[model samples]
Target: MKIALIAHDKKKQDIVNFTIAYTEILKQHTLFATGTTGKRISDATGLEIHRFQSGPLGGDQQIGARIADNEMDLVIFFRDPLTAQPHEPDISALMRLSDVYQIPLVTNLGGAEVMIRALDAGFFDWRKLQD
Candidate 1:
């Protein structure tokens, strides 16, 4: 499965820790992430991730494109809801695309944990049928 990992500034550490804990399960699949988040995760977990521009610079849109093209299966985005984001529109569009394409999107640590566990348990194998 192709998984996109994204996180806001304040949530970066949370995502990094999540990836570290799930490195074994995550390394089995293709990983994609926004610039800084990718660097952080790769550094902490030693996982190979395809990196795009920073979210404010269009990374969210890039991943959204993959979702629109049916090239991405899941999204694990750690959003910082308490903070104001300069790229709110891009973020909203990315999320809307995930919904429009019926992709599995996880927005917080709790949800991400459950989704990653499900991924490990083959609950998402049905996504292969869509290919």
Candidate 2:
């Protein structure tokens, strides 16, 4: 399964910590992430990640494209609700694409944990059949 990861500046550390805690399960599948978040996660977990541009620089749109094309099965986007983003449209588009594509999307730590646990349990294997 291909998992797309994105994190706002404030939530990057949380995403990194979460990835570290679930590195074993995460390592079993392909990983993709936005620029700084990808580097942070790779550094913390030592997991290879395909990196896109920074979110404001078009990374969110890139991931949205992948979701639309059915190239991604899961998306974990740790957004800081209190903070305003310059590329809000990109973020919104990504969320809409996930919904339209029927992909699992995690927008907070709690949701991310649930999705990660499900991934660990192999709940995402059904995606292979659909592919």
Candidate 3:
């Protein structure tokens, strides 16, 4: 499965820790992420990730494009709900596309843990049918 990883500035550490904990399962699939988040995850866990622009700069939209095209299967975005984001419109658009496309998205660690486990268990094989 192709997975997009994203996180807010304040939530980067949390996402990084989540990635580290699930490195074994995550390493089995292709990973994509926003700029700084990708760099940080790669640096910390040594997982290969295709890096897009920083989220505030356009990474969210880039991933949304993939969703629109039915090219991305999963999204793990660690949003920081406490803080206001400058690129709110883009974030909304990305999420909207996810729903429109019927792609699964996990906005927090708990959901991500469940999703990752399902991925390892071949529950996502249905994604291949869409392709």
Leading candidate by TM-score: 1
Candidate 2 stretches greater than 4 Å from native: 126-131
What is candidate 2's lDDT per residue for 78-119, written digit by digit as tens?
999999999999999999999898898889999999888877
lDDT of 2: 0.92
Q: lDDT tens digits, residues 20-89, model 3?
A: 9999999998999999999999999999999999999999999999999988989999999999999999
Candidate 1 lDDT, tens digit per residue, 6-121? 99999999999999999999999999999999999999999999999999999999999999999998999999999999999999999999989999899999999999898899
lDDT of each: 0.96, 0.92, 0.95
RMSD (CA, Å), each prediction: 1.4, 1.6, 1.5
TM-score of each: 0.96, 0.94, 0.95
Q: List the residue pairs that clash in candidate 2.
A: none
- Model 2 clash count equals 0
lDDT of 2 at 15: 95
Candidate 1 yields a Cα-based lDDT of: 0.96
